[model samples]
Target chain A: MLVYIYDGSFPGLLTAIYESYYRREKPEEILAQDQWQHTLFAQEVVIKTDEKKADKVYQAIKDKISGFAARNAYCVFLAEVPGAEMLIYNYLSRGWKLGAKLDFHLADEAVLQVHTVAKKVRQEAHRMLGLVRFRLLKHELYYAQIEPDHNILQMISPHFARRMADQNWIIHDVKRGLAAVYNQVEWVLTPLERPKTISLDETGLFYESLWQKYFSSIAIKSRKNLRLQRSFLPKRYWKHLVEMDESRSRFAESSVLSPQSPVKTYK
Target chain B: MELLEKLEILANAAKYDVSCSSSGSTRKNKAGGLGNSYASGICHSWSEDGRCISLLKILLTNYCIYNCAYCVNRSSNDIPRAYFTPDEVAKLTVNFYRRNYIEGLFLSSAVITSPNHTMELLTETVRKLRNIHNFNGYIHLKAIPGADLELIKEAGSLVDRMSVNIELPSASGLKLLAPQKKQDLIIRPMDYIKLQIYEHKEERKISRKVSHFVPAGQTTQLIVGATPDTDLNILQLSEKIYKNYELKRVYYSAYVPVSEHPKLPQISQPPLLREHRLYQADWLLRFYGFRAEELLNESQPNFDLELDPKTNWALRNLHLFPVEINRADYETLLRVPGIGVKSAQRIIRARQVRAVTFDNLKKFGVVMKRAQFFITCRGKYGGQISLENKLLRQYLIAKPKPIQHSSPYEQLSLFNESVPSIPSEVMLSNLTGEL
Candidate 1:
């Protein structure tokens, strides 16, 4: 089995896809530089990142199939799954053969895997639109920090820019160390220094308390469903919410409808 | 009064209006505007009751002239009343949107002084939010019933969506529960908005510069379990409203008993499962191509709480079962128990290349547990038994978890003798079958 390794960048993965195609042999796995494991019987190939080679493959995908297919590949690239590098390569090779009709091959494993992985990225982007909480910084720019499982900063920024067009805001992806900043005009992506700390203003604290009060007051005391709340806005996303501050979650514990009865109240 | 005090009363009054969606409007942000709307709504937070909070749902004022019996803000209730000026409401909306606390504003009100006077306030508030404040966030305003048509029309053009609640399902139910709110007064504004929405589309097609009216269309709420109106009556009414008004949604708010009217149920909790079943049947009517009359009838006026509306419908129509997975049409595929709109489309696309077996069908997102009994894979049966026996019915619906006896006395009596205890419907059905 031949295993190909490359740097952990989108262009690097596309270059690896190009190398495996000309090698005329199917590799068992495509590994990022950090993700490689030593196996006794496997042959290894190390590929360097080449912008020209990656561009050629990307353009070939758009020319042969459609730009829509190229977008599918890009979304899958951001998924950052362990072995997505090879799956995308195989899917595109089949696309070259099928031309614009490649999307019809939903039964193929490589095609279905890319579609499934891209769907996860799309869902994460959609969920972040709802879950992102902005804090008014002392500097008066709206600042929000998210640590999503997927790298969805680029996908979700356009939504905030369209909605919060008149305000200056920054959405920092803490896990990925990148930020999408909107300066009351167009948005720009820049590298963010990790472990970013923000100081909240007095007005921000005032509204935060009001929001926490409104959030707690709106729920019906007779129908408290923790499991349902956890399913929609999971525990992982709770830490970022202004309403899910530590005191209220503890306050919520004493207000469970009934600790014993799990039956939905209806006949 | 403090902002917190006013927010508490207004939000408490507005909680019963269960239309929480900030969806279906494609309004975009202008150069200096504050926000935009997405086609599918965004939910910012979930409350402890597991309800989504998409918009800052608050009443403009809780002071009222009319006393609708079911309303928490009725004049006889003796609750504290508060009002927000138009400037205050618009500033609140812009501030909340900036902090990502809400998608937009859902502004509703009681009949302050009179209906026309109240609607003028609502219109002024949205007009300021759009024109003066330059806030383009998704606004869902209330269309005050019996308000002047000019006021409703002028407000409809400024906001993304408007709703005039039918409130009760039947005219007699309206007369009994809310004596002052006649059926004609509620529906007249609805019809006017519907016609304006229709006319705006025609106007937009003729010239690209013509402004859109109520771009997200209209929606309304119907209170479930407050009256004798059955599921049949409610669904049929919603069907007419959808067909006639081209309504975007018909939200069902399970009656939370806040008042002690003699005609209403004296239950401790809302009929939640009934509301859930109504939502499922409503989905069937909207997306699954099932008509209202087909799901329920006069003989069986209510839905079965044990099973979902789709599964219940499939059980009643046994002859439509065991559809061929490889050859069935899209409509027939949707009728199968586990095949939804998404999975059905996936099946149509995937089966064009190769024959789909039951295993492959699972990959397309068909719930194998439910679909196995309703479909055939290349003339091969996947289910153990067809829909010929009652066991199939029992297997499809999950048995409710047994009731826990947490009290000490009830637990102590368990060791005394043979306790012929039936904790759930599953056990009761099993015991009756044995006898």
Candidate 2:
């Protein structure tokens, strides 16, 4: 059995694919260098990332198979799940023969595997569009910390750049030690260390408290279903959300103080 | 009053309005604007009651003049009343939006002095947010029923969506519970907004420079289990509204008894399962190409408690069952018990390349448990039982066990409660009878 290994990068993966075709031999397994496990009987091949060769393979996939298949390959790489590299290699090998009709062959195991992994990555990126809560630090820099289940920092940053175009912000992924930093013009993804503590500005605390007040007051008392609530916003995401934390809400203390009158005029 | 206190009272008052969607708009941000609208809306959070918190749903004020029996903020209730200035509302929306805490603002209000006056307050707040704050987020404004047409038109041009709630299902029910509201008054603003949206779309076809007028279109809400209306009445009304006005959604809210009156039912719990059934039937009308009259009739006016609407319909019309999976078109496939829009489309796409087998159906996202009784693969039936309606129903009926609370101590505390817990079998029959 033959095994192929490359550095864990998108270009490196594409280069490995390029080698499997031109070398005229199909490897039994394709893995990233970090994920390689030693086996006694397998022949090992190491492949380096060549930019020109990776670009040729990328252009060939887009021109021969379809642009949609090219996007699916990129999303699967970002997913970084175990055995994803092998799935993409098999998908492209079959896609080269079927051309643009590759995705329509959903009954095939290779095509279905690529489509399913890409969908999971896209869904997590969409969820982070709403779950990232930003806090205002000193000097007016907006900072948000997220611990997404997948590597979605690059996937969701373009949305924030388009929506919050005039503000400087940073979305830090604490689990992966990565961040997407934006400077009101463009954004770049870089490695970032998680901070031990974070301090909010004066007005930040005020707005957070106000948001907590709105969150608690809007729930109907008669329809209290914690099971349903956990289904939508799962318990794993509660640590970062401001409204879900019990210690920060102060809801019980505030509701105890009764108002003076039911009718009051305001200017 | 502090702004925090006002927000508490007004937000609590507005919690009963359950139109929480912020979708169907693709409004782009200006060069230096603060935000933009998403095409498919993002739900920022879920409340404790399991509802999606997509927008900052609040009221500008809770002061009212009309006394509706079912409303918590009726004039005779003497609840805590507070108002926010237009500037205050604009500031709150911008701050909350900056923190990524909400998609936008869902500003509604009680009829303070008159419909026109109340509408002016709501419109002015949206205008301030757009012009002064340079905010381009999704905004859904409520159109006051008896307000002038000009006010409704102006509000429509500034917001992403507009709604005018038809609180009761029927005209007579509206009269019995809310004497001050008329059906004609509620529908006038809806009709006017529909015309304006049509005109805006036509103008945009001529030139791309025309601005949007309610790009997300209109939606409305109706209270369930409050009047003597059946599920048939609610579904037919929704069908008429969707056909005539081209509404994006019609939210059905189970009546959470805020104040008791002689006209309202004395039930302790809301009819949530009935509301869920109505939503299911509504989806069949909108997406599955099923008509209202086809799903329910005078003989059987409500959905079965153990089965969803689609399964019930399939069970009644057993002649249509055993549809050949390879030969059935998209519409026929949609009528099957467990086949949905996504799976039906997947089957169509997958069949173009290869013949789909029964084993391959599950990979395309088809739920074979309910579908096995209704579909065939290459002229061979996959169901385990004989094709009889009664036996098929017995096999298909979802037997959801009564939810067991974790602790026996909690069940013991319920012994002193006024309402006795009914057995699951009796409760199921009772729910079907009541609906």
Which candidate number maximizes DockQ? 2
Minimal lDDT window, size 10, model 1 chain B: B407-416
TM-score attained by model 2: 0.91
User: lDDT tens string, model 1, B97-206?
Assistant: 88888999999999998899999999999999999888877899999998999999999999999999989899988888899999999999999999998898998999
- In order, what lDDT does every prediction score? 0.85, 0.89
Who wins the lDDT comparison?
2
Which pairs clash in model 2?
A: none
In terms of docking quality, model 1 is medium
Indicate which candidate wins on TM-score.
2
Any runs in candidate 1 off by more than 4 Å, and if so which? A37-42, A247-267, B398-435
TM-score of the second chain in candidate 2: 0.91
Interface RMSD of 1: 1.3
Candidate 1, A1-267: lDDT as tens digits: 888888988889888888877877777788888988788988999889999999998998899988878989988888877667777887888898888878777777888888899899888889999888887866677878798988888888888887887778888887877777777767877776543234567787788888877787778766678788888988888877889874232211111111222222211
Supply DockQ values for each candidate: 0.54, 0.64
Where does the lowest 10-residue lDDT sum fall in candidate 1 chain A?
Answer: A250-259
The alpha-carbon RMSD values of the candidates against the true structure, listed in the order shown, are: 10.0, 11.0
